[model samples]
Target chain A: MKQSLFEIVSNIQIAENVFKMVLSGDTEAVKKPGQFVNIKIEDGGLFLRRPISVCDCENAGGSGKGTLTIIYKVVGKGTEKMSRMKSGTLDILSGLGNGYDTSLSGEKPLLIGGGVGVPPLYMLAKKLISEGKKVSVILGFNKKSEIFFEDEFKRLGASVKTVTVDGSYGLRGYVTDAMPKDAEGKDGYTYFYTCGPEPMLKAVYKASKTAGQFSFEERMGCGFGACMGCSCRTITGSKRICKEGPVMEKEEILWED
Target chain B: MGRLSVDLCGIELENPIIPASGTFGYGYEFAELYDINILGTFSFKGTTKEERFGNPTPRIAECTAGMINAVGLQNPGVEKVISEELPKLSRCFNKKVMANVSGFSVDDYAYTCERLDSCDQIGWFEVNVSCPNVHGGGMSFGTDPNAAADVTKAVKRVTKKPVIMKLSPNVTDIVSIAKACEDSGADGISLINTLLGMRIDLRTKKPVIANKMGGFSGRAIFPVALRMVYQVSDAVKIPVIGMGGVSSAEDVIEMMLAGASAVEIGAANLVEPYICRDIIEKLPEIMDKYKIDTLKGIIGGAK
Candidate 1:
């Protein structure tokens, strides 16, 4: 419930309609692997809030205060306006949604994401690396132009693999295809963490050599649980993607019907 | 000091902020995140007799300063709501929660009312009559004056609880609709639900939402809501709960001045979870700066 004026530290358009924005704010509240922040792009009436994934939370960078970094794609009016914003403070509501559970990530951890879904993987990759665990990322995009942050994931000290629909990239196929095939059926990875479109998630769920975590995306009214705009069925029952999780264990995830 | 108490149908709301129905789900979900008893009463989701699955996929579409939704009255039926949801909601807030109910036929309205009659936890009942997504329910009974009165009469016969008729803006004459509800024994009126809107994808050349048409709610619809509330308040005798595109504290004051006794924030809640609380706190400061004493005197005051 902490609202602060987050100055835009940096913004980079990784791909068309896809941008990565870094805002300087109190990054303490948001301290999870798969959490989010609700950003109001326009100052005027009806600044329709958009939910962006927490890319990184910097505390001791230059000043010890803190800075919240969010990564999002320009989907609609809010995101489009957010792209035009340059080095100004925007009212940000951070520490939203139940983030990823890192305790579950075992010795060998694998992360998979498609397009904008790749943002949360960066945070999870950092968390996994800090714990002295082996981390691997299989990044997927429609084409080479849509691919982003391939080298960033590598910098986290994890094995990063890139895949593209067109043959202009590394694996030149789906992330599931790019998965370490030699390690399949060898109990190589304890858990699998993934985020992307419903189709991509379904494919990852199908291709996984082991059970772990999967996140779902839905049309959200409130990024919090108030609106009930984002709900997905799980093994237990109907759970809110924003509240219960935007990231859930693979065992708990009830794939799209 | 800020005047936090507001009377909706002679029932005092601790604060003026009432969470719009369909937005707040029985009050338990948000109660876990924050204190529910902090500011005001929360209006539970719309309930009918039979359970509904709501509209098909792509029910919502983003607009310029707002959104359009076709959520077709998805609920667990009135019986389950009274027996289940009410018990859960009582643990969250001590305030008498407002029940936002909907029905299809004349019998549906009466049946739903009868179920909620003995529930002391519910102080007021808002009959939602402006849902454009429902075929024979929402706007069907709203547009016609006779149909509006008939539903009001049916509900009044069953429940001693105060009834507030939520009127839709998708009508030719809103004044007539407001007057009809009051004449038939409604205790209050909630004006200006979403306006009928449609958006098309230029590239695909198809409707943006799965359902070609949807109900638009957001800051873009505020002016129309204000005008309708002004007209209805002048025409009717009951209290009016105004809504539609209310995002900020200033918008709440504008709705109150335009004729609303208490404003229900719809799209604004969709934008920010804490926005209603934000507006409620800032309201008094606005009132003090304007040199206003009571909120009652400002209703229908142009300028």
Candidate 2:
């Protein structure tokens, strides 16, 4: 992981309580699409750094400098403080967590995301499309006002399907309601990747047709795996959600009841 | 040795900035960010006789100027730590490492400490008797003087290394516990582990941590830690390793002046990641500003 000061390029509210923040920093340490960054919001009351996934990135090649785009919901005091800031350098620990493995995406890959989980999938979708694979995305939101990045995924050359629970916009169910059933068909997805609330992830896990990957969320201490505060039981043993994964393959996931 | 160096149980540290147990992991995790040899010596993760998965999810809860964690001494057991963690740590860290052992029983503490004592890299065995998250074992031994002494005497029997009894601050008399351990042959003392604390989620109306309560530490606990360090250091003759929310070079110097021979950076490492290295680099500058020549001279200066 690389600790660097990221200059806030832009901070704007995109959806209801959701924000898009652009930071210019040394992005050389970020290796994969779904990897995260732990940002320290300099607030008097806050002690722990907030871990946010890299929504998108522009690498400076070998120069070791770049721009990072992160989307976060103002959930607590830390993110609430982050949203109020328009400028200033943020001490960020970049290139954290084991990101998604794009190599496992065969030909036609399906991406499913819910709420704040949609941010990481944006970069994952970008990587998959750039690799010449056919990408299909299903974005989920609670209501019309809560929806975000619907057009951004479409602009990345991925077939986008926006789902809302309230029937406020697009399909009137969930991301699982949009999954194509046949895995062997020409249009069927060869693999699937998902990130969302635990209930949504569980629904998608049961509804998925192909072996895929899922990104997880946990209350983390050190987003770099040292604290063991975010550890969860996997089939193999215990793994830190920040280190061994923010992403795990479908076969390896042993979801808790 | 350099001016930053201080004697920690006969083994001299390059500096007084030791990263506390649970915060530093096996040492190699932070080694990915910078050379960890710059630290005096860090206490590794809390290990037990049996491998513990620890408390359930939502083990961490954020508070004002601190965090409450019910991690409950999750580890790969003593065997895996020796076979897996140590070998990985030995690659990046060249200096001796402090081993922090926690247990559900007095025998469990002895077993884990005895097993880890065989490792050559271990400089001190920090026996944790102050974990508040666990059910019956951890903080139970620390709240009482006799139980604290019992665990200390049992662990001291197996290891020749300096046994630092890590005391919890949740007790009525922290000094009594420290004195008990010292009287029972504890080579040194380390306090305060963490203040027993809890946080309630406003939305859920339930505890933020799944375990309901956790050990709280951060910048907020520094004064309480310093006060306890003063009291414990004054009560006991052995070296005192002070921790609990230590973040800066100023805090380290403050801890030493309050009677700590060495200070451990806890939650600050989670916030800064480079805090130990930053504190070590800044110690000399801070010292020069304070007109202090040697860190060893400042021990208990405030007293």
Give all candidates' CA lDDT scores. 0.80, 0.92
Quote each prediction's TM-score: 0.90, 0.98
Query: Judged by DockQ cut-offs, is candidate 2 incorrect, acceptable, medium or high?
Result: high
Cα lDDT over the full model 1: 0.80
DockQ of all predictions against the true structure, Cα-based: 0.38, 0.88
Residue pairs clashing, model 2: none
Q: For model 1 chain A, where is the 10-residue window of minimal lDDT?
A: A60-69
Write the residue-wise lDDT of candidate 2 on B1-303 in tens digits: 788889998999889989999998888889988999888999999999888999999999888899999999898899999999999999999999999999999999999999999999999999999999898898999999999999999999999999999999998899999999999999999999989899999999999999898999999998899999999999899999999888889999999999999999899888788889888999899999999999998999998
- Model 1 lDDT per residue over B1-303, tens place: 236566789887766678788877788876765687865676788889887767654567778788887777778788889889899888878888888888889899889878888899988989988888889787899999999999999999998889999999988899999899999999999978888999897878999777788888888999999999889988887899988888887888888888888888887776666677778778889889888776766877774
